[model samples]
Target chain A: MSNIALRKIFAMLVEKLARLEIFLEDKKETYDRPNLKFVISCEESLKEIKQDLLTIYPVLAKTFEGKVVSAEETQKALEVYKKCLDKFLELHSLSSHLPLNPIASETYIFLSDVLKIKKTFKEFDSRIVLLTQDFLTRNTHQCYTNLPFVSDIEKKPMALYLPIIENSNPLYWPILVKNIFGNIDSLKASAKKHYEELIGQKASLGQEKRKILEKIALQLTYDIYSMKLLGPAYYYLFVEAGVFRSIAETRIRYQPTLAAREQILFSELERQNFAAIAESTHKWFITLSELSDEMHSTLGFKVDFSDVQPAMDEIVARLTREAESVIPEKYLFKCSDFCVSLAGFERLKKGILVASSTIEELNKSKKQCKEALCEVNFTEKTEKLQELPNTPQQIINAGWIYSEYVYDDLLREVLKSPQLDYTPFIKHIKNNDTLLLNSVEKSRIFEILMKKEG
Target chain B: MLLNKKHIMERLVHADPDKKIFITPFINPEEQVGSVSIDLRLGTDFEIVKGFDSSSKPDFNVSAEKLEQMAVKKKVTVSADPAEPFYIQPGAFVIGYSIEHLKLPSDLLAKIAGRNSWGKIGLFVNSTAGLITPDFSGTLTFGLKNMSPEALPLYPGVRIAQIYFHQTRNSGSVKTEDAGAGTCEVISGNIEC
Candidate 1:
């Protein structure tokens, strides 16, 4: 045989073996039955074959000059390979029929090792072909008899055949029959190679081939067991099994290329940088509200000395109206108080306007507050604030003090409460038109009154 | 206005002179108190008795003597342990029965408040029935749902809630006459005697 012909034959044999490996893996993955013990044993035997193959792989590559051989002198070698293939098919079929008994499990492993040796042969020739054909035919006959077991599950009768004369696709039938024959032939060839390596004196080569065959067998057994165990509810299991089989088969066929791509993507993600923003907008608003309330009380009532009762009534009415409307609930309480202050002719009318406007301005100011409340910027200010031990206990403990400017700005805008008679403060503002009642001084007067008995 | 702990304590102890009231301090208080509201706590003892028929109210009469004994002794024992006892674990919470069986005056209304100290530890108190009717007498049951993830352990004899007395106008005879008459009619309808 020419080198090209030899190469083609070797490639065909490898393809057949690959197909068998896939079939076994699929069977193992889908296997799920009370008789999983047999599947388990078959799987273990295949695992040994797979390991043996791994060891013999480099040696096979070296012998074949990095390629499988094709030559006339290797005929006898191919015969040994055929016998190995026959034994493998027989073991698989027989194991599938019998229960997972220990004795049957040992017999399956013995056949698997015999098959492993045949897979290591480096030649494809006529003499090897004859031996392989003979063993293959014998195994196929045995497999035909075992087909009844599976056929019974399918509710099909054994030995039922349609006449060729009446067949619509007679030519297609012959081709189908030929393909089946060819598949069996390929199985025989690979089996012969597998057995040669198994029985060979070279322990390391045998070990490697054994491991590869074992893995393939175990994979098939697992698939079969899973299928039987899971019953009808094994859709997801089957999908996962399919994916695993695809990945494994792809890895075996194209090892370095696929792995390199995965490595590159992983490295890229590892070298990337990211950041996150943290801000408590709700807490800030709460603190601001508290400060506004304090400032309102401190500023004293913005009541007019003249017609105080009527003004208070009008304030109440306005508050009720505002409350009835869709204005925010927070503004409802403040609106009544603001109206009352305005009615009372109180000082700090400008402050009241600012406080009232704060509600409308809240949407815009929210953005400003979010930016200002960052922890990094406040760290220094917080340190300085902590240093100020001389501050009043109330001031130090107040939540508003933590963010003074935000609260102070809000508080400075609130109109004084109408309940306080701020006539003197009003007079001072009117007469001077410049001197305003400072918050500190107002806070003191309010503090004294708060301490006094009502 | 600006009531502190001392002021609150004094008010609770001395506010009502005509009515005799008791103030029991809970050492490891579980009730939470807010600025104005008090959160109630679940008591240690719980019972999962068979549900009573909707057609009839619970037969408190059968257990009246035992209840009286419990009230006098300030302790009651229950039979048939709960499947789980709905444990208000060390930091967990469970609903509890209030010790107070209040009879509100026609002119006044009272609201229960949770203690302030308990609120600091993140306990929450709430009740579905806020108003105490003038003729009410049974012990009030608080739905002491714990908002905190931690189990709030409680035991018998713990004061889990405080009753706040609010004074309302008498509204003279017009309001009281109608309300009192309606209640009397309902009681008469329910009891054959």
Candidate 2:
């Protein structure tokens, strides 16, 4: 069949399968058992078809065992595969609106797409292999080995093509004629060693010597990155380090000592702080464990709190059980002391386990309050607060109203006398008063006093 | 008439009751309200003007888009405690914004001024773009210049500027057509001079 005819048939099949999946999904809700079986059957059939197609797919590679096949035939196969890939992509996009099971569809789509990529890359690999074999056998292809910017050109033929293909370095011819025979892992290791050397040189250079170091590192990275032999880890490290270094250099240039010093200090401080926090946490855990042990000994029972960090409620339950059921009245004093002497008892008393200590503290506070209140002298000394000049400036100068007690006393006195106009007092409070009041309180006072005047 | 403390408080009590007048994280009256104006705190974002050649006149013919490329923007997060600060060196100019985003009423116009405390240290701000017209909304941008011999540390969330709100008898609209014109949008960059 013609390539176009095959592509059309493949596209139609994909479309039909997507529609069938969607139909099965819709009917699955109503006929759960039967529809599920039908869906599974359809899926299995589709899988088998996909496998059959994969098995029969002709190798588009232009060579077998060091012999070159016709270039025209290889090119025609590539064109047919390219057309099929385009149709698959179209079908994939169109099926997006179908209500297929999301997980199943995604897994299938990913699997198919990955297979396509593998097949394409395999063809690419085959082309390289053929070209390499051709270069070795034919003297005419020997000039291609003189490609510039390739390190140990005989060992890393893939690296030469990488830069031209990825970075589009026009200085070198595209390496389409051959596949590399060298192990990719060893090539990556060499490139990594090369990178380490570049960075080592960069590290030794001072601020003034950075420009040349950066230029060299960038050039080396460009060459390696174009090769595409290195994994994502190497790619990310190389790119991120280069960008970060450039930015750091720029900042160092502008601020001289300050910017560089700040960054170093920040990094050091962060490291130290994280270490300190870890140490502190470890100490705290040990302290808690020791405390728990002490409690266990005091109770004279093996509390099965093997949990490294039991919930607070669980600890409370255990403590309460020990306090109420296990301990005698004589031991109450010991438990009370534990609760009262230690901090955090105030917040933890809500659980009812620490009620005894809370009651003791409250009783003490009540007695103290009563004693203090009894000492207040209420024998009315009719000594009036000396009235100052009513002017705003004089009132501010006296600083009497600024005092919280005095302001309250004065306001009380003014309110008692109906004849006294509270305008000046109100004005002073409105303008000069810096007392912290809630919005509701401030507005209520100001609205009654200022609104009448306005 | 300049709004006094009482008037300011009264207006705030009822002002934008539903929409909140767009001031983010509003402060209580006691914290920010002054006798004559409400204090505005410094924001974290800043645009610092780079040093230029004093020999050549800056090309004014550069478009608004081009002028935006000239200034370098920096965001300096300042701690609430006054100990850590973003320093501004002598003979340096930087742009800062108020932490609060205010939406002024149609009858109320505002003016930005350096606090007396900041001005005493030879830290000048808002020499230009001081006027905030009525109906203006957004964080006000500040043109900060440190004229002191010593480097001044500016802490964000501290009182850097005061905004005196004035009530106008004539509620005429302030022209905003030319407001954002030639204004640089990005936090920092050099203009096409």
What is the model-wide C-alpha lDDT for candidate 1? 0.30
Q: Least lDDT summed over 10 consecutive residues: which range in candidate 2 chain A? A: A385-394
Superposition error at B14 for model 2 (Å): 1.5
Stretches > 4 Å off in candidate 1: A1-454, B1-44, B47-86, B89-94, B100-106, B115-123, B134-138, B148-151, B174-193
TM-score of each: 0.19, 0.29
The candidates' DockQ values read 0.02, 0.02
**What are the per-residue Cα lDDT tens digits for candidate 2 across A1-454?**
2232232222223333443454555656776675566556555554554443343133211121223434454344334433433333333333332222221212122222222222112224344434433332221111111112122223445654665443321111113212321332343444344434444444544554344333332333322322122111122222222222222223222211212222222232233222221221232223223322322333342222122112222222332332233223322222112212221122121111111112323333233323232231222322121111111111111121122113333333433444322343444332222211111112222222222323
* Model 1 chain B lDDT-worst window of ten: B184-193
Q: Rate the local accuracy (lDDT) of all candidates.
A: 0.30, 0.37
Off by over 4 Å in 2: A1-454, B15-22, B51-58, B63-66, B72-82, B169-193
**Clash count, candidate 1:** 104
